[model samples]
Target: MGYEGEEIEGYYCLLIAILGNFDASEARFLYEYGPDHPVCQKILKKRPPPVNLAKMSKEEINQCMYRLFEEGYSKRSIADLFSCYPSTVNRRLTIGKKQDAEKKMEERRNQNNAQTDRCPEELCRGKP
Candidate 1:
């Protein structure tokens, strides 16, 4: 049967999902056996892995994740790309949100403190 555009896209998505679940040796085995193999067919038919965030050490990954999040990618999508568990993505996003909130609060506090440190005369003069 000839595949349509959607079908081809779906097949690639399945392949990507399966690839994420496989280690290097398994991937090599699949590559050696070729796509026409029964195992390969079965893997392709199987459901893709759940969305999970990958553990990232590099600042680049962090920046990419932030950008993806800002661009409105679902957590599952990010997890799928990173080959990590969905919970990992959620945890990281949560931590980031908390840190951002804390930073903003600190900035506001500092601004308020600076304003308070200025004398009333300075406030009237708009010099502080």
Candidate 2:
């Protein structure tokens, strides 16, 4: 419901086309979490005959979570958005937030050091 107008229609159409006659909740869930998933793209591209989204497998969901994490959504945020638990999101991020945080910190430290190393001449010289 919070989705923008055009997005809502796209969500319903995609779900109806793929899954057939999904209830509002199912439609909503898929809308928030399904599209843009790499696995979903592959599945949609090469669906088995008599495609049934109700039969969506655990592997497909895991693949969705993998894609979501790769896009930098935090575990807690993903859980909240998808009506799952943090553990579910945490289970998906193989690289984990700790690694991301450490990398960010390292980059920040390097940037600070680089700034401090600027030549005094560069700092004090007036523009001509």
Q: 1-128 in candidate 1: lDDT tens per residue?
A: 55686577555556754755654444554655766899876644442434333555544455555556766766876777677788887777766666666778999999999999889998999894
- Every model: Cα RMSD to truth: 11.7, 13.5
Per-model C-alpha lDDT, please?
Answer: 0.64, 0.59
Q: What residue runs in model 2 are displaced by over 4 Å at the alpha carbon?
A: 1-24, 27-88, 91-95, 126-128
Residue 27 lDDT in candidate 2:
51
Candidate 1 regions exceeding 4 Å error are 1-67
TM-score of each: 0.46, 0.33
How do the residues 1-128 of candidate 2 rate in per-residue lDDT, one tens digit apiece? Answer: 55798787776767665564344654555466685776545434432223233666755556555556666655664565456798877775554445556768999999988877888777688422
